[model samples]
Target: MKIDWVIVGAGFAGATLAERIATHLDKKVLVVEKRDHIGGNAYDEYDESGILVHRYGPHIFHTNLKHVWDYLSRFTRWRPYYHRVLAVVDGKKVPVPFNLNSLYALFPPGQAARLEEALIDEYGFGARVPILKLRESEKKDLRFLADYIYEKIFYGYTLKQWGLKPEELDPSVTGRVPVYISRDDRYFQDKYQAIPEHGYNQLFRRMLAHPNINVLLNTDYREIENEVKFSRMVYTGPIDAFFDYVYGKLPYRSLRFEFATLDREWFQDVGTVNYPNEFDFTRITEFKHLTGQEYSGTSIMREYPYADGDPYYPIPCPENEALYKQYRLLAEKESNITFVGRLAQYRYYNMDQVVDVALKTAEEILRGI
Candidate 1:
């Protein structure tokens, strides 16, 4: 039997679109996933120790988009979670974003105040800017902050995380680290920030529960896509694989996660910590903090960065981009298929962004349906 839609990859892209299209457009969708479960890279579950752990490192739901938050809230309740990050620096645990609180906490009160004045004088008051982004700021004025941040927090950590020199990477990468004048140490300042009350798996389970949606796990698209016919297909898997890499392998960076359970009640004060100064691994996350799980024992994950793994991130290289552009042109030429999601688009988007894309994808598909 021919289905109205065939959605590949049960991650946020395929799952969100499948449910939305099936319900709103009255179309039947069959979502096939290579993985056994749903929710994609942001998938979370309670471990054997009863701590909710992210299967693929840490993922926080924080977005300025109110509509994305509202759309997700329909499926699950949220726990008000303000993600705070601590960076290990100079044999001390300092809060990241290099805020006023972190500064005062790290140095003498008088010196901290003086340095704050110097910074504000250079960047202007309430600047809310990354040091690198300040065009007219004097080099001498930035020398202290930039050198200190680069050495203590950014350099080694970035090297291990992405396997690239900080200088070689995009300036926007460094722009993410802001030197704040306020005591707000929270990592994200998004208007809406929260974690799912029952975890993301349940949210996905509810989203894809429509009768018009069929799910097939551990199914290879190449093996079965030709056998089953459909009106149209939405693929969220890697675009390179779809066309059998007719151009060349598009660049992607992947991660490796090692997790363990501890007999202790707690491990860290916060959800995430960046150990830039100490270890080969960039960060070690305690699961209970992120999941809001109340349990005696705790679970932690150690992340190791490799040259390549499962292509968690698309390397923002020029050559790969040109190749993806060629594939995109080919996809346009093909006409019957729509490619969405991080792997397909070769973008580095978090959960909310993927959801937004999926919602838009559904709307476009329904417009034609």
Candidate 2:
């Protein structure tokens, strides 16, 4: 039962690290995932109508890091892609990122230009007087901004995602949201953007193809038959569960989705459209927009947030963080285990940050090994 390392969860955090450590460091690792799949939430495969759908939810790979992009390139060639978003407000659909195109599309042409000038004058972006950093004026405040974003783009969607009004959640939760001045509607502005040409599952399959990495799907980490054989264990599962919930389970928000196959060729021209004014669901994502697969049919998903489930988004409130601290302190006392990834760290991180953290954590662990 001897092994060099026991890595838990086969998601990007563990799978990417396993590839690096086993290939370069020549470490014999046992990779165990609580779920039945290797790709975790990023897993995608062809659906009934030949649409490559995101099984858990929609995820776009966008990162500013070149090393990560290069490292993953070893696994699969990327399909050149750019992600965009739209909002449905007052029966009008427009681009997200709040750009000029969306402005002109939303308002009458002349009024749109006037509003643009006024907004730019008030809130200069990337300039000496950046609106985001400036002190609030008598006219500008939390209430004003929240109301504006909520009414036009975020309120209904936020309500759909959190099951609460935008006012109920901390502004910090929504603070990272922006009011962009440029006409660029691309949801993310990154150098390299793509879905794996084959698929995410294939990339992960190649990532864990090394002889030294043994991946066990359909087996939860808790069900590992072997006992204390490895020198160290990296547990990427939920931290509260790792400690057996001694600190009362840390809060996490999850989503439930209803996917459908439309008889039409397309649902929307854009990939995603946020229902800022309609539907209990936050947004509808058309798989056709994401995958670029050609077919007479299409697939769409309506995302509904739930208070309980597999713990997607960690609750951002300080009380939840304080509780996570107790579990972390207990994890610190464990001599042979390391916690990693979103659930383990109890933070909301994008795909790149998780991959970067996994790479860094693997580097630290290699020194120890």
Candidate 3:
């Protein structure tokens, strides 16, 4: 095949770039996906019970970036879903981020009222304070609240998810767990938050349907790299793997999902219910809530964090970052190869952020060409 660009991985990163190059730059692009499917981690499909479920895990599309939302709007319509997550604390489901509403959910009326007033006085209303930052407060009430959240919500879940204590991991990872002073139970406050009307796979199919774009599924780029004729390469796989892990393998945390189809209309109140202090798995996600599916039977997935699976989350630690920097230095020297996406960049990025990065990378490649 005569290819102007070879895109490794048919996820958002590669698919977006291939579509842009084919439609805008008028280049023939070849997308090679190792998986038998497209859409990478965001892939979703109907199960045997006729219930739509996310294969990898629950991916809620929420981003404040207008350009990113506008770009994806070309492929699929929106479902306008506002994600709500609940953490099982003290035998009750409380809103995650440990908001004021959660305090009322878990504590008595008098205590919850006192804590809410104190929080508003200290941090002001609607302020989002990191759990670690709140823990450092000189005030006794705030410190107590922080300790409660850290112990009940953050500590156990972080330990299970990353296989490390919350304090042991990088602050960037731990600090992401915030305590919102407001009563908003929504998981994210991004301006635009929704799921694709159909599924992510459908969106990917539309994105890669351009005449100049060719998709090769279940095909490894390494197997065909020598045979294929392409001027430039866009790699969306692991950066270390691309260079054969020359600087040692970068650490990543993978997940094992156990899905079950139950003969019920709904499973949980929210889309995701986090089992922080109870279960071995990090959380359980009910797909009907996220997908807005009206199936008679519901499907839910239990995410068990493990070390031996496809790379899911790049472990955010000082040592891993330093090692990835070495790979980045090597990647910079390769003029024809461009690495974009979560695994390739070795950073934890949301779906919209990955799309934005791919768009920027595509523009850069076009200018260079």
Each prediction's TM-score versus the true structure: 0.95, 0.92, 0.98
lDDT of each candidate versus the true structure: 0.82, 0.79, 0.91
Candidate 2 lDDT at 73 equals 89
Name the top lDDT candidate: 3
Off by over 4 Å in 1: 124-126, 134-136
lDDT tens digits, residues 90-150, model 3?
8999998789889889889999999999999999999989888899999998889889999
**Candidate 3 lDDT:** 0.91
> Candidate 2, 201: how far from true, in Å?
0.3
lDDT order of candidates, top first: 3, 1, 2
The parts of candidate 2 lying over 4 Å away from their true place are: 125-146, 164-172, 225-228
Per candidate, the number of residue pairs that clash is 0, 0, 0
User: Which residues of candidate 3, in runs, are more than 4 Å off?
Assistant: none
Between candidates 1 and 2, the TM-score winner: 1
Best by TM-score: 3
Residue-by-residue lDDT tens digits, candidate 2, 173-218 = 6654556767677887789899888889999999999999998877
lDDT string, candidate 1, 1-369, tens digits:
679889999988988889888899888889989888898887888788767888998888999988889999999999889898898887788888777777677778887787777777766665576645543356664676667777777778878877776666665566667777677889888899888989989999999999999999888877786788898889998999888988888877778898988889998888888998687788989878877778888999998888766878776656667888998888887777899999999877778889999888878877876
What local lDDT score does residue 299 receive in model 2, on the 0 to 100 scale? Answer: 96
Model 3, residue 63: distance off in Å is: 0.6
TM-score of 2: 0.92
lDDT of 2: 0.79
Indicate the worst ten consecutive residues by lDDT in candidate 1: 132-141
